[model samples]
Target: MSNDRSKPWFAPKRYGYGAGLPITWQGWALTVGYVLIFIGVINFSEQDKPGSNFMSVVGMSVFVVATIAYILICAAKTKGGWRWRWGGKP
Candidate 1:
């Protein structure tokens, strides 16, 4: 971790008060949530009329479940005492 703000995105930085990036669970949550939300929006929009296409409804439900599953997975992984590594095992 370096304090050089000019470093590239690939470089890790000590991001907090004392330097060093703080642990980021929000990132995973946001990624999963955004993806699912986008998929749901697309499916919902494509379906056009409601109560007509069962597959669309199912797909929408799956999207919601996947989003929730991602959140849970991220939460468990992040809070279970495992170290966060960038490119290799921690």
Candidate 2:
């Protein structure tokens, strides 16, 4: 015989072993931002001309700004953003 039981409303959902924090939209944003910033910085450093790499520098700056902005926004908007996992929650 098979038995099925409905969980109580207040009971926490059972996650599989080693289940980690769920990913949120802000996590995706931060990841993309960091990747862009890293690639931009590396590309900018590799350019040899006096002004040839200016765009890359600008790109990197934009990415840094975007990352900071998104982080702040996520802090205000989400409970599962990176900061929450880092220090925002117990």
Candidate 3:
């Protein structure tokens, strides 16, 4: 093995256990938005009200859409795009 320090400490590894958190503002926003929506849904569901099923469906849809958007954003940042590869490059 060679002491290859060409890559910066923040640069992602081609193969490793896993990459850390999102490096972009959009990524962080999406993550925080998802969490807030999730919490809101849980609180709303716990209330005694009619049409809870409909609310649940809507919440689920929002969650799914957010998740897909987050995934796509991450993919766009990576070279392999949705595959297991290194990211955080210029």
Q: Superposing all C-alpha atoms, what RMSD in Å does each candidate have to the true structure?
A: 10.8, 11.1, 8.8
Ranking by lDDT: 3, 1, 2
The clash count for each model shown is 4, 0, 0
lDDT of 1 by residue, 1-90 (tens): 865333221213223111122244444445656686777668665866766776676777777777677545444433223334444422
TM-score of 1: 0.37
Better of 1 and 3 by lDDT: 3
lDDT for 30 in candidate 2 is 57
The pairs that clash in candidate 3 are none
Which residue segments of model 3 deviate by more than 4 Å? 1-19, 48-52, 85-90
Tens digits of per-residue lDDT, candidate 3, 1-90, equal 754333212323455423345555645665687688779877766663675587677777777887787655554554333435533343
Deviation in angstroms for 71 in model 2? 2.0
TM-scores, all candidates, are: 0.37, 0.39, 0.54
lDDT of candidates 1 onward, in order:
0.49, 0.48, 0.55
User: Candidate 1 lDDT (Cα, whole model)?
Assistant: 0.49
Name the Cα RMSD for model 2: 11.1
